[model samples]
Target chain A: MSDQPTPTFISLDDAAAMTEGTRVTFIPGLQALYSEALKNVCFVKGISLTRALHPPMGIDKETGEDRQARLFELTSQTSLPTMFHDDERPRNVWIEQLALAERVGSPSAPALIPDDVAQRVEMFGLCAVILGEDGMVWNMRIMNDGPLSRKYGYNKTASAAAPAKVAEVIALIDARLKTQAENGSAYLVGDAVSAADIYWATMSMCVTATPPDIMPVTAQNQGMLKFFASNAKVPAIAEVLTPRIEEHQHYILKTYCETPAVLGGDPL
Target chain B: MSDQPTPTFISLDDAAAMTEGTRVTFIPGLQALYSEALKNVCFVKGISLTRALHPPMGIDKETGEDRQARLFELTSQTSLPTMFHDDERPRNVWIEQLALAERVGSPSAPALIPDDVAQRVEMFGLCAVILGEDGMVWNMRIMNDGPLSRKYGYNKTASAAAPAKVAEVIALIDARLKTQAENGSAYLVGDAVSAADIYWATMSMCVTATPPDIMPVTAQNQGMLKFFASNAKVPAIAEVLTPRIEEHQHYILKTYCETPAVLGGDPL
Candidate 1:
């Protein structure tokens, strides 16, 4: 396992007790790609956050539900990676979350969004490919959980088309990475690290297995992850997981992210 | 049929000739919900837009493809309702389009976003229920186009669940509307009209057919729309199309949105 130090995590009760600072609720595991990406954004930007577990991580055993109903009262939805900054309305959408991070980040830190309009558009577009509905991770979910799992309920025709759709997305990522590598740029969008880079680095876990050393997980989770990875490795999908793409994922993770993931679970 | 005057529409060729100011590409048909919503937002904000037809409207009969190809080149995708503001990058996503309207809207125009943080959150949440993924229109699409029509490829399980999913969303909308009406607020979220109100007003077309006078469509399109409406009126769906929801939609259309939709097409 990597020697990276584990980041501190506060319980929901502890996080809720703080009435004055920023608090975030996220799924506390490696497989929670959005959570990991949001956490990385905060880390890179040097934004202080009180992290608390959500859903399964914080479920009430007796009721088999979220321990806290207050989250629902606050955001009116059960989705995670939601942030509450002071008394501001809870930021639930990914784009909103990124905007919030950009706003609250330390002034000394590098900006996650490109200042140039063209580059900013390009960055948001690439991030959408990684995080938007029907993007790469979405297809990956279809492969692992079936299309209906998320309530999308596409027809058998679309269900059958998942592999091709995923293959197309992977090819797009591979082509982008190849071009960026040729230009000698380490980041996805422009000269500096952006939300696109961080998103891909974390979201890649859905397709390719992260080394246990880089992102240690519970043994049970590791097995579950392997199942998901295997389910996602259809022939078309396998063809597009190019070396350049994998290299970029690893590069971004090791260089920019918190290794060992700060996930408080036991190592596989 | 509608005593309401038809709005003027510029052809794509005409719109493209103008070299200055703001331009937008949108589908030129009654059934395009997002297009109608975006157009309404601009109309209410008093933002002048050079409207150009997209996709099937501008498709070449010989090749049966988009005549301009420039739209795909500009946005990297074929989806419509994209806006280009004074040499800025094209805004394609719904949220981005709304943000653009907010930015360029008349100085004295009422804000589409509520000034109160809680109301803003509530507004967005309601808007999400109407337009977000797995929201009302999405379910309407499933009812009309089948699950496989889009790239989402859900299984039979989800396909089977669409009616219930749609019913739940409708109930949620009905509940929200009922509460707002009880509070004597004409709008969905706050004291004044907001994006959420306009979004629901336009998006409601998917479930309920608009009067022919107000949104006159070609006879062929009228038949097609009837089919869509019929398909969407499954038992569970019909139960939630409460009278309050219908009245609210008509009220918003007549009071705020441009009558006859400025859709340059022929009357039914």
Candidate 2:
């Protein structure tokens, strides 16, 4: 770890040079929880990542091409975080990233995926719901758009249905946490920390911001927090973002999330 | 009651002449459940109606104008089942129709809107959910459109969320029914039949087709029944359209809905 307090974010041009080692394409912001979580997983596994820049919603100034288009060329999908590992298949989704973490992790490191088959099934099922097209994040994006913009993008019926859909998933997660509490298990699946817990804790980074040390809270992230906080006005949204859920997320972060890796540009 | 088995559908021109009594503007079809239910209300009230034709999805050949445009001119809205009573204000919505039924119903007829305020509130709330934009019907419409057409109408996120939204409302209705069953009340609200029962029964017309004698099932209606029935493949939709719900709808039609009126036209 460098003595420097701030991490500097590297440009895509700089990142393009590193093809031999672990390379990750990510945007540094509260919204980039999936990317950050993946980075955290790599850190825990003692895998060093050469951080790459991913611009938000526009063309990259240096490249003069759509940043998203470049990202698509790198990884088949546009959404971050995109990972490249020395002549290996590029990993785009969080699940694939988690699998990679487990494969290369140091022998002393704890397994993120459960050893038991039934527990693995349950954990993966919940993760699918969280990451799937019809899952929490997708549904939240639908609800996030303002009513007018939502109508044009989503049909009248879909605009009408978005909130309830988000609520249902939130309720599912909340219920799982409640059950875990009742069973005296602090983690999402079984008694130990798993990818399910990490994924959930990080996914809610915007909704419930982690501490400044683990994930820096910036002005942009503040805006995200407000966006998530506003959802609390909706009763169903409020029900799932309960104290218990927040406590569980914080607990996972405290136990598993180590000192933030210095991925170079001024600590996001 | 007349022994005539054949049901007569009225023409627009003939129905137009009678302004002295209850006047209903409706098209004869399974889709015209709202209008049909209102007509049934009038029949039970012993209030004679001059049934008029409302053309489906196109211009009226006789008027040389859009049938829906004409309806909008008359009622400020194009949705079917518009009603005009003498010089009284036109009643377009189910709520207005229910109010009209209560005001003009015969002394011998059972009340549709419950007298109790709490019961009325509960009934209306449920009705709003069923009929509102986020309700089962609207969500069903969203899901009903083909995937290609849906892209233009609704965005990806909204499209994905539609099924769950429909499911939530279905679950709500199912839960209410379960509670009612536990309490030994066949009706949705209090013991006796109310607008809630009639409205739900009518709304679920496609889900559970009415008997041949009461609501003649046309080819389109049969298709609609199939559409609704197919939704049973989804567990949430299947839960609402349960055997108990079907039985309840049939009970309402048999007990409350009476003889088909002779408004003078070929059977629809």
Residue B268 in model 1: lDDT? 47
lDDT of 2 by residue, B130-223 (tens): 5533355656667655642252245556656667766665566666777898999888888887777777776766444445565544544556
For each candidate, the alpha-carbon lDDT, in order, equals 0.68, 0.63
- Highest-scoring model, TM-score: 1
Runs of candidate 2 exceeding 4 Å displacement: A1-4, A13-17, A29-31, A59-64, A146-156, A209-215, A259-268, B1-268
Lowest lDDT sum, 10 consecutive residues, model 2 chain A, at A259-268
Model 2: lDDT to the true structure: 0.63
Interface RMSD of 1: 19.9
Candidate 1 yields a Cα-based lDDT of 0.68
Per-prediction TM-score: 0.52, 0.46
Let me know the DockQ for model 1.
Answer: 0.02
Query: Over all chains combined, what TM-score does candidate 2 have?
Result: 0.46
- Candidate 2, residue B223: how far the Cα is off, in Å: 47
